[model samples]
Every structure is written in structure tokens, then in C-alpha cells.
Target chain A: MKALVWHGKEDIRCDTVTDPEIQDPRDAIIKVTSCAICGSDLHLFHNFIPGMLPGDIMGHETMGEVVEVGSGVNGKLKKGDRVVVPFTIICGECEQCKRGNFSVCETTNRKRHLADKVFGHTTAGLFGYTHLTGGYPGGQAEYLRVPFADATHIKVPAGIPDEQLLFLSDIFPTGWQAAAQCDIEPTDTVAIWGCGPVGQMAIRSAILLGANRVIAIDCLPERLSMAEAGGATTINFETESVVERLQELTDGRGPEKCIDCVGMEAHVMPSLPDTLLDRAKQMVMAESDRPHVLREMIYVCRPGGIISVPGVYSGLSDMLPMGAFMNKGLTMRTGQTHVNRWTDDLLRRIEEGEIDPSFVITHTVPLAQGPEMYQVFRDKRESCVKVVLKP
Target chain B: MFHFSNIVRTKGDPEIVKGGPSLKQPADQLARALGWFSIGLGVVELFAPRRVTETLGMEGRETMVRAFGVREIMSGIMSLSVDKNAGLWTRVGGDGLDAAALLSGLTSDNPKKGNIALALLMVGGIAVLDYRAAQDTKPRRPPRDARRKLYPNRSGFPKGIESVRTAARQIAAHAKTHLKTHAETNEVKQGDERRVP
Candidate 1:
């Protein structure tokens, strides 16, 4: 089998690798039919991620057909069932799972995914990226060994397009989580920072959840326009102060909920070197330069509002105002999205035509072109909201 | 609720009108035991404050501190358990630790032991009150919310003690996570028992 390998900083290549097998009874080996690069994958491409090393598998978002299941595997899922595997590998019955925090499951990716030669250190568990999460191999390859399959893999309901369902692996549910964190009250207004695929979905979710108004912020005309089409009031942060526009729109109360879809790679003027993580995050979302938008998210939200941050923050960075957050009584919720929680609902919405998230998927590349497509993504030339790689 | 007066206050004169034994003896014992506990805690904190802080996360600090504050109040009640002549009173005061100080301490380059030592000192302050309360007669039980505060309160300390008990169980559960991090590393060799496989 072959996988898209992350060789080093800004370095990724398609390489031949060992075929995956069922290493555990609860495991299932799947033949990946499609996969997409996640924003966090770009975090791996840049040096912001600590544990990932050269030649580690690249993509986390996947849709595939199960070819084998381990001996003790239950749930009655068969070998030929088409499924969407969630990005986070989780054991269904762990203490974390019991608390509904499935992303940080106790029995998820226990095996080191990245090859030993990549990094000198081992990590807790995560698919394909590296340690920091257990380094289990990822799905950007011909075959993917999925541990805790019953807990992490969701069957694609019949009638859904493979392209539309691919996102169920990450963005669809992540976008839903960002929206869910708003804890929307029917009359509330929401401001979403960034208008990439996830941000677009968040706007859709906010509307679906009955928000009175939705505001989308970003610099790109294409994404901003998409947001407008989706019924969101668009704000080009490059042209106007996001906080000002939001206050003016909300009659000085600010939006009830604010979300940071742009993570560390936020766009800001006179950028700092340390904020490269912010920039890298932007590039993953297919943006080039931006200051950290999380700060703006804080400045623009109402005093007693919620800030839902689903953007990936690897390790820790500086510059959040804890005192202000405390003084304002703002409730901020974050961490990796527990996609399993929202996958079923999101898929149903997609099926019902209540949403057409597939519009955000602007590029489709063959598996072999994964490397070149990444460059197109890096250059921000295609206005790519998402790039699906067909295997 | 039992009536509180200057007699239970333990004012300027160490030797008041009359009681079984002085508050000094148990106060001193608790102080000594606290010193030992402080050293052990300091060792843990000194070596791994980041581990503790990370597990505490953003909202956890306030919750943990409130819990510890309640535990301290309980310790004050437990102190009444020690000295019959001693009295129990809950001290409810101002905002405890500033966020800047909390962040600074959390991300500090200070020796782990020193951080633990400081935490122990805070822990000791409450332990002393607990020890003293143990020695006193069955004092009035305070309400849950009132007793755990470090400052003054209208409702007595018994309820505060129960709050501490609940908070302690929560804190203990959180504390076990830190221990598990180490325990997992040590057990990695023989254990293929990892839930994910």
C-alpha cells in the first residue's frame, strides 16, 4: 500500500508503505476510497506540530470500505460496508467516553503512528500525525487500520454522495461543534471568524439552530461571497475592524456567540515570527497571511457571551487575555471536535437537503496529485475550500 | 447555629479566661504535620506543576481552589475535632489569587519543590484551623457554601465542610489523572491491555 507521507517541514510525498492489517480484535482494516487534507494536517506540514516527523501518513478525513474486521469486533458491521471514519480514534467505553469526551478517549490511538525514525519521542495517541496523539497510522493511504472501529467509524447512509460524506470524517462535525458551542438562544446573533469550509458549515449550523443573524469574517472574496450566499452578513477584516462592524451590527451588545475558525494562523498586520503557527493554521485552511483572529474573537463578543474555538492549537501559544475573559464572564469551549457526537445529525441534514456543504468543496484531485494539490492549497490560487483526493 | 463571641475568637491574649488546654499544642502539631505534607506536596509540585496545571486546564483552577478552600475549612472543622477548648470559625475573605499570579506560577521556571512548598503553605494555613477545630467542643456546623470561604461568613462552617468533602472527592479524581500519566508509562512494558490496542 502507499500513503501520503509528511517528510519534513513543508515536505510531503506519496510513498510505498506496508499494507495495514487488523492488529487488534476491535480493529478493522479499510480500503480508503477518498480522503481530504484537514486544517490540522497543515499544522503537521508546518513545524508547529511537535511529534510528527518525515514520512508520516498525511490525511485524517476519510471515507472508505471496510475490508476486514478483527475477531472480537461487534456492532455487526460487515467487510463491504461503506463508512466514514471519524478523525479521532476512540474506545467507546473509556472514562472519557463515558463523560462524552470521546476525542480524548482512553483507548484510542495507543500505537505510535509515525515511524520511529521520524521523531525521537513517542506520543499518547492520534492517527497518522505523530505522538501527542498515539501515532497510529492515518488514512491518506491505500489501506488504513482503524482501531476502535465501532466507536469511531460511522456507516454512510445510502444515497449520500461520497464527496459530501467525506467531510463527515472531520469538518462537518467540527463545524457543528463550533456552532453547538454557541449554545444558541433563538434570538441570538453569531459572528464566525474565517469562512473556509468549517466556517461555512458553522454559519449553516447557526442558521439551522435558529440564530437571528449570522456574520462571517474573512479576507477572501470567494469565501466571503459564499458566506453571503448562505445568508450570513459578510465582513472583510482587511477592509474594516471586525469588532467595530460587529458592534455596529449588534447595536453595541456584540454578537451573542463568536467562533474562531481560524486558529493560530490568524491574520494580523505587522505579523510576528512566533505567530507562524497562526499563519500555518491559515495556510491549512488555505489562507496565506492573517493575524491571530482569536484575539479579535475575544474583542468582538458580548461581555457575557460564548466563544467556541475549534481551530487547532498545537502545544501552547501566547496572547490570550485571561483576566478580560474572566471579567467578562465569557464561556469559552475548545479542543478537538468529538465528531462521533454530531456525525449522525450532520449526515441527516446533508441527506435532507437542509444543507449543501458540498459547495465548499472546490477542488477534486487524483490521489497521485496530492503533493501538487497541496502547493495549490499553499498558494491559495484555486480558492480551494476543500480538496478531495480520489484513490 | 451556635452563638459566636469573643471567647471563641482567640484575641490578643493567648491565655484567655479559662479552657481545657491552650490552642497552641494542637495548632503546633497540625503545623508540624502540615510541614511534612507540604514537603511531600512540594516535591510533587516542584517536579510536575505543569502536569498538575495542564490537568487543571482553564476553568479547573477556580474549581480546584474552591475545593481546596473548602477542604481547608473542613480541616478547620476537623481541627475542632482535636482540641475541646479550641473553637471553629470560617474565614471568608477577598479574591484569593490574582490570575496573573496564577498564570505566572503555573508557567514559572521556579524549582518544582518551591512551587509545591508554596502550595503546601496555603494548604497549611487551612490545616491549622482544622486541627484547632478538632480539639474544640462540638461547634456549630456551618452551611456548605459559607464554611469553605477563606474570609468571614454568617452561616457556620459545617455545610462548608460538606462542600469540602464533595470538592475533595472531585479534586481527588482529578489528582488521580496525574498519577495515571506516570502509572501508564511505568506499566507500558507488560501491558498490551491498552483499550484501543
Candidate 2:
């Protein structure tokens, strides 16, 4: 089947990869209907996440119909049921899973059983990524294998559009997790450190959770404006020192809660420049772009406030002031969203018309135009919010 | 004065009195009280820790820890902080009086300097516990997998076969139910809340 393959640095092309078949009883073969280009996808183009081999099919955020189910598959899901598959493949019943922590399932990457022992103490298998996550193929193809189908895929309610349910794969739950992690109290002031799609989603979620005021910080005019439209006060870090402005607004205490929507690839100075050229190339053009926004998040947060970082960060992080964090009594939380935990509620909310997370999508291109959309998105065009690739 | 001998007989040993309440429990209570006191000071410090420290005229971190530690210990040892009338520990006169003066002395000292010391002391214990947890040597936990046991154990399927079989059975049941409902044309259809394709 044809899949968008990540060959090498800055190289992604629609190519014919092997069709996915159900190899395990708990597995299901899904025919892709919708997939998206996440900011993290640009990482492959930029070579941020290493071990990128030729013939790797990219794109994790996807929703599709079950074409076939393994003999042992359950949950009453059947062939043709539309479902949203989580980016992280998990086996739902390991020590971490029995405790409701499915992200780090022990048997995640195995074809039939858990790995011989385990991978590096913690193992959560993910799609289309290399050996670090057991290298299960992703869903940017005509058909893809879904492991632990009962645990990973949630059938979408009928009334919800495919575009809306597609984000349930990663971005929606991630943004919700970011806001929930902040633990913002009612009427509390919040400053999200990025205004990307995830950041904007968090902004809306912050309001949903009753944060009376939200100040969004980003260098992009488009993202900042989007934040404003989503009911958040905007801050352009490029034009002003974020900490100083936030302090001025908060009577010198800073925002009571801060969520870092920008992860490792944040548009900071020197090594991580937010220059127009870089933003155009990385955020707009690349398929896997994750820029760290941690420095800004810590700067504008109030003492004793919560800091939630849901942006994808691999291996290591830098430019952090542990002393300041410890001294100020800030509570820090960083991790991948447990998407399955939020899918039911998010789906219900969507069905009820309570939230239209699809507002972030400003562009929808045919699946074949993925290569072009990648460039348009990477260019940081003024009009871009999110790109939905319809298959 | 309520003497130790008047209320109850000492049982553990002559020197180590068992009948009279020793300072340990009282000290623990005082330590807890001090925790709340420091938090109140912090609330004020949030507005102005420096002001509180200056008004109290206390030393910095070191002095605050010793002073707060000594205060809690003295409160526990004497039971004087809890009740002023019970001053048996103060029978030592001048030394006891000097120790008893500390809590009262807080208001007289520069609030800025006093809070600087007290906050340091108050936060120290929690810091140590956190630091120890960080330094633990346990292996980083391995990730978990959930597919191994997808079925209820009561079902007569083998452990390995249970999950897939149970899932298949459930899927078959759903299909059967849907077919039955559709075939029975006379049956009324309540809107299925969980609509699936």
C-alpha cells in the first residue's frame, strides 16, 4: 500500500510501503481515512529525532475504519467501525497499565508477545518511529496495523465528523493534558508559552477549566492572533520580554499557571532561533518540528504555580533553571498525554457540540498534496493554523 | 504550681518520669504548629518576605533553623508554648526564661530577617525528603503491556487465548444483537446512544 515514507533528512515522499496485516490476536488492520502533519512530524525533516532510516512511513495523528480485526480482538469493535488510534501503541495489561498507565505498556512493540525483557527500563511502543519505540509502522498508509486494538483505538461517535475525530489520535488529548496538568484554579491567571495549535488548544481548554484570564506568548503573529481569537490575551516575546510584561500584568507576581506548548524545538535564540527563516523552514516546512518553549514558560509563571509541558521532547533538555524552579516552589509536570483517558469525554463533548477543536484547521488538502502542505506549514505562512490531510 | 508528683506517679524510672507528659509528643505538635506558622509567614512573605525578616531582626537561614528548631524543642520540653500556666520546665529560672522568650521575641525582631531564617528552617525538612527520593537507586521501571490479559479470568479460555477469544465473542454478540434487532421489524428502536458503524 502507498504510505508517506520518511527517507532521510528533509526528505518525505509518498511511496509504496508494505501493506499492514493483523499479526496478533489483539491487533486490527485499519484503512486510513484522515491523517495530519503534527509539529513533531517536521523533526524527521530537520533530523531532530535520530535513527531516521529510509522507508519509514510518517504521520501518527490519524483516524480510520477497521478493515479487519484479529481473531482475539474484542471490545465488541468490528470490521468497518470508525476508530481513532492513539499514537502510542500499548498492551494495556502490564504493571504500568494495570495501574492505568497505558503509555508505557510492556508488550508494546512485540509482534506476538512482550519483548524478550524490556527496552531501556521503560518501553512504550509508538508508530513509524525507529528502534527507540520498537519501530511499529505508522498510519500514513492505505492500511496500517494497530496493536492492542482494544486499548489503543476508540470508536468515534457517529455524529462527529472524521476531521474532528482524527485529532483524537494525538493533538486533542495532548492539548487537554497540557491544560489539565497546569492545575489552574477558577479565575486564576494563566500564560501559555506557545501559541501553536497545541498551545491554542490549551488556551481554549484553560477557559473550559475556568481560568478567567489567559495570556499567550509566541513570536508568530498568526499564532498570537489565533490565541487572542481563542479568548486569550496575547504576548509577542519577540517584541517584549515575556517575564517583565507578565509581571507588569499580574501585579508583579506573574501568571498563576503556565503551560509549555512548545517543546524542545522552541523558537529561542542561538541554537534554537525563532528567526523567520528558521520558522519558515522548520515549523512551516519540516514534517517533524518541535521547538522548546520551556525558558519562556518558567520566566512568566508565578511562584508556587504549576507548569505543564506536553510538547514532545526526546533524550535531553537544556537551558532550564532548576534552582529558580526549586526556590520558587514550582510544580513541574512533563510527559506524553494519556490519550485513551480523555477520548471518551472529548468524544462526548464533540458529539454534544460543546467544543470544536477543529477550529485550528485552516487548511485541508488532498492526501496527495501532503508534500506541498508540509512546505506551506513549515513556511509559517500568516494564514496557517493547522493542516488536515484528507485521504 | 501543679507539681509532677501531685498529679501521677512516675513509673519508667526515677530520672525518666513516665507519669508526667514528656516533651516528644509536645515537640512534634510544636513542630507541626511551626510548619503552619511558617506558611503564614510565607503568605506575608509573598507580599514581603524581606519586610517580615527585617521587622523580626533575626539571623539568616542558619540562625532561623536553629531558632525554630530550638523553639519547637523548648515548646515540647517545657509545654510552656501550649499553656503559659504550666511552667514546670521554667523552674530553671533565667535559662528557662530566655528560652521562653523566643516566640514572643518574633514580633519584636525585624520581620524581614526573622522570616528569612524561619522560612529556611520550615522548608528544610521537606527539601531533604524530596532530595532523598531523587537520589533513589531503584532501576528505572520498565513500561507495561496490556494485551496479555484482556479477558476476565472466570471465562474458560487459556490465559494466552482469553483476550482474543473474549474480544471475538464480544464482537460476535454485538453483531448478533444488531442483526436480531434489525430482523425483528415490529420491535421499537430506541436511539442507540453509542452509535457505531
Candidate 3:
């Protein structure tokens, strides 16, 4: 099987790998049909997130038909069942899973000790992520071995294109969660930072959830244009002041709901001194994440409002405005998406034609071209927004 | 490396059978090599400034040598980072300073003029490589002012934006009504309890 393997910083290779085998009764093997290069994958590509070793496969957004199923799957899943494998592997019997906190399912992570030390508790095992998250082989390959397959998969029916359903594995539900957690009110002005794929989806999700106005901030013209298409008032932070523009749009009260979609690697610019400082500290290994978006969101969000974060932040961040956060009596919510908690509703919405996630995909290529697409996506060349790799 | 990584894999997980071409370009490889070279050279200059100055016949300039070493180290770190282009450009500028300093030591009175000339030649060569790597490693992102293909029609809504907005409004209205009705029922229940008492 051919898979995209992580080498080091800025290095990925399409390598011929041994076929995955079912190690447990709950495991199932799927012939992957489609996968995607996620914005968070850039963190792994840049070697920013620790625990990823050389030869770890690189992807999470994946969907395919089940070629083999374990006996433990019972009748819930069988051969020929088409499913979108959610990034987080979950054992449905766990206490966290019972509470719909699937991303922190207690039984899934094989390397719980590492996560326990770093995060104070283990998170759900994620595909192709890192060793700290169980180091499972990812789905960016010809085939994937899904652990806890019966509970970890979102079964999709026929008649829908792979493009429409593939994002259900990650970004679609992730974006929806980002907006849903905001508890968006019809009169609320929701300001979202970053216009990447997740950001674009969040924009649409915010509008569908009935925010009075959805403001999207990014410097890229193409991304901003896409955000506008999704019914968001776009802000190009490169040319305009995000704080000032958001203030002007919200009548100086600041946006009631603020979303940070840019995490870890905030765009470094001379105009943003904090971003520059963060980058410097990041390069020196002093700070693990660039929290410019977090700082900006805290500073610009309305007093007593909510700041919802679906972005992936790896470790420690410096110089956060905890004073403002505490004084303003604001609420902050962040986590990996409890993918199963929202996928059913999102899938219904997709079937009802409320929104199509495929709109964000600007590039599609063969799995063999996955290596090149990573570069294109990372550089944001050719106005690239999202990349789907057909395996 | 693959074998070592395989050692960590569980029994059933796939291991690499054969490797393919890396995504890294030649220029990226060049930048990496240069980055390590810069760090190695910087460490020597930093820790052994007297040796560096003696080799260049500028014995009294150890402090300046150490300063250059710090600059080299910083540039090397940047070069090894995602912003390798900036690091390479910094190296290019550092090379200019290096050349000028070596030229200053090319005086007739200096016994190691020949050594200074050799160092200058090496700097000149490294400068060219740095400049090339810097240019090649520059991000391929389209110019900010370039004509962009805007997506005005991709609303992701198959039912059109207006219809979705209408549905959202109706949902909100229904929720409001539901809340009002529930509140009215609760008030009636309270009134009934007081009347019974």
C-alpha cells in the first residue's frame, strides 16, 4: 500500500508500505477512497507538534469502503459498508464517550502514559497524528486499519459524492462545533479569525446558525473571497485593522462571539509585533504555540461574551491577556471536536442540501501527488484553499 | 530511520516497504545543509574566538569574532526554520560583512594576508550559494497584489443563502415561541399551587 509518510520538517514522501492487519477483534480494514490535507497537517509537516516520528503516515480526513471487518464489529459494520472514519478513535463504552466527549475517550489511546504526562490526561487516539495519540497509521494511504471501527466510523449511504461526505471525518463537524459552541444568537455578531478551510466552514456554520453578522478575518484574497461567498463580511488584516474594522462593524461593542481558527502558527508580520515576538520565541523553543489569534480574540471580543476555539494548539503559549479575560467575565471554550456528537446532525444537514463542504476544496489530485500537494497547500499557491487526495 | 521508526510500531501497523522521492526540493536540501554548516561554524567561532582570530591574523578582534558568531547562529536557526529564506538572506548580508572584514585584514603589514584572502574566497563562494538558496527557497505564494480568482458563488448552500437565512429565522422564531409557551405554562402551574394552598 502506498502512503504519505512524514520524514522531518517540510518532508513527506509517498512510500510503498506494508499492508495493515487487524490486530484486535474490533479492528476493520478499509480501502480508502478519499483523504485530505488539513490545515493542522501543516503543523506536523513543519515539525511543530512533537511526538511525530519519521515514517508515521500523514492524514486524518478519510472515507472509504470497508473491505474487511472484525467479529467484534458484529452486525453494526460489515464488508462493503461505506464510512467516513472520524479522526479520533473512540471506544463507545467509555465514560467520556457516554457523555459525548468522544475526543477524550478513555479507552482508545494506546500511548496514554505519554499523553497523561503532557496533557494531564489522555485524549482519544487520532489517526496519523503522533505517538502521544497512539501513533495509529493514518488514512492517507491505499488502505487503513481502523481500530474500534464499529464505533469510530460514520456510516454514509450511497448516492453522495466522496467530496460531499469526506469532510465529515473532520473539518465539517469541526467547523460546526466551533460555531455551535458559540451558542450563536440571531442578534450576535460573530468574528472569526483565519479564512482557511475550517474558517470558511465556520463562516457558513455561523450564518446557518443565525448569527446576525459573520465577520471573517484573513490576509489572503482568495480565502476572503470564499468567506464572502459564505455570507461573511470579510476583513483583510493585511490591509485593514481587524480590531478597528470589527469594532466599526459591531458599533464599538466588539463582536459578541469570537472564534480563533488560527492556532500555533499565526502569520508573522512586522506590522504585528506580537506575532513577530511569538515567532522568535517559537524558533528558540521557548514557546510551543503562536497565540496571536488568542490574544486578539480576547482583546477584541465583547465583554462577557464567548470565545470559541476549534483550532489545534499544541503546547504552552506566552503573554496571553488573562487580565482582560478575567476582568471582562468572558467565557472560553476549546477542544478537539467530539466528532460523533455532531456528525449525525451535520450529515442530515448535508443530505438536506443546507451546505456542501466540497466548496472549500480547490485542489484534488491522486494519492501519488500527495507530496506535491502538501507543498502547494502549505505555500497557499495557486490560490489553494483545500486539497483532497484521491487514494 | 524507517527501521528505527518501525521498532516503535505495534505488530499490526504498516511499516515502510520502500521509500519514494521526498517532497523537499533541491534548494530546500541546500538550505538545510547550509543551515547546519552555519551553526557548526558559529559554534567554533563562538567558543574558540581566539582560534578563529589567530587563523585570520586578527588576534585582537576576538570580541568582534564572537559577535559575528552570534549573528551566524541566529541566521542558522532561522534558516533551519520554516522561514529559511529569511535566514539565507541574513547569511548573505553576513557574508558581505565577512568579506569586508577579511579585506581590512589584507593589509601589507599583516603576516596572514594569504589566509585572509583564502577566507575571502570561501566567503564569496558561500555567499553565492546563500543567495541562490535564498531566492529558491522564497515562498511560491502568488503576489498579494496579483489578480486573484474570487469565489463569489460558492456559498456552500445548495438551497441558496436567502433560503437558508429564512430557515434559520423560522427556527429561531419557533424556539422563541416554544420558550414563551413553556414560561406561560410554568406561571400557570405556580398560580394553581398558590390557589390550592
DockQ-wise, the better of 2 and 3 is: 3
Q: lDDT per residue, candidate 3, A1-391, as tens digits?
A: 9999998998899999999998899999999999999999999999999999898999999999999988899888989999999999999999999999999999999999999999999999999999999999999999999999989999999999999999999998998999999999989999999999999989999999999899999999889999998999989999999989998998899999999999899998999999999998999799999999999999999999999999999999999999999999999999998999999999999998888999999999999999999988888888899999988
* lDDT (10s digit) by residue, model 3, range B16-123: 889989877899999999999999999998999999999888889999999999999999999999989989999999999999988888999999889998999999
State the C-alpha RMSD over the true interface residues for candidate 3, after superposing those residues: 1.0
Cα displacement (angstroms), candidate 3, residue B73, comes to: 0.7
Worst 10 residues of 3 chain A by lDDT: A374-383
lDDT per residue (tens digit) for residues B55-123 in model 2:
556434334434444443433332222121122222223223333433545554455545545644544
Q: Pick the candidate with the highest lDDT.
A: 3
For lDDT, candidate 1 versus 2, the one ahead is 1
What are the per-model DockQ values?
Answer: 0.01, 0.01, 0.81
After TM-score superposition, what is the CA distance of residue A252 in candidate 2 from its true location, in Å?
A: 0.6
Best by TM-score: 3
* Tens digit of per-residue lDDT, candidate 2, span A1-391: 6666665544566654446666779888888888888887875655677555555567788888998988878655699898988988867777877775666676785432323333245567777765466656677666778878877788886766887778888888888888877876655898888777788778767766667688888876657666776667888876787778888888998888888877756663553354333333432224234334565566567888888888776554444667778888989887777778788888876776556777677788777667666656765653566888876
lDDT of 3 at B115: 94
Q: Which 10 residues in a row give candidate 2 chain A its minimum summed lDDT?
A: A111-120
| Candidate 1 per-residue C-alpha lDDT over A1-391 given as tens digits, one digit per residue, 9 for 90 to 100 | 6667665555577666557667678888889999987766776765566766444567788889989998767855688999998888877787787777877666664543442333333322457766557656678877888877777788987677787788888888898899887887667888999887788878777766667788999877667777876668889877787778889999999998998898765553533343555443342334333436666667778999999998876544455667778888999898788888888877776675556556667788877778767766654555666788887
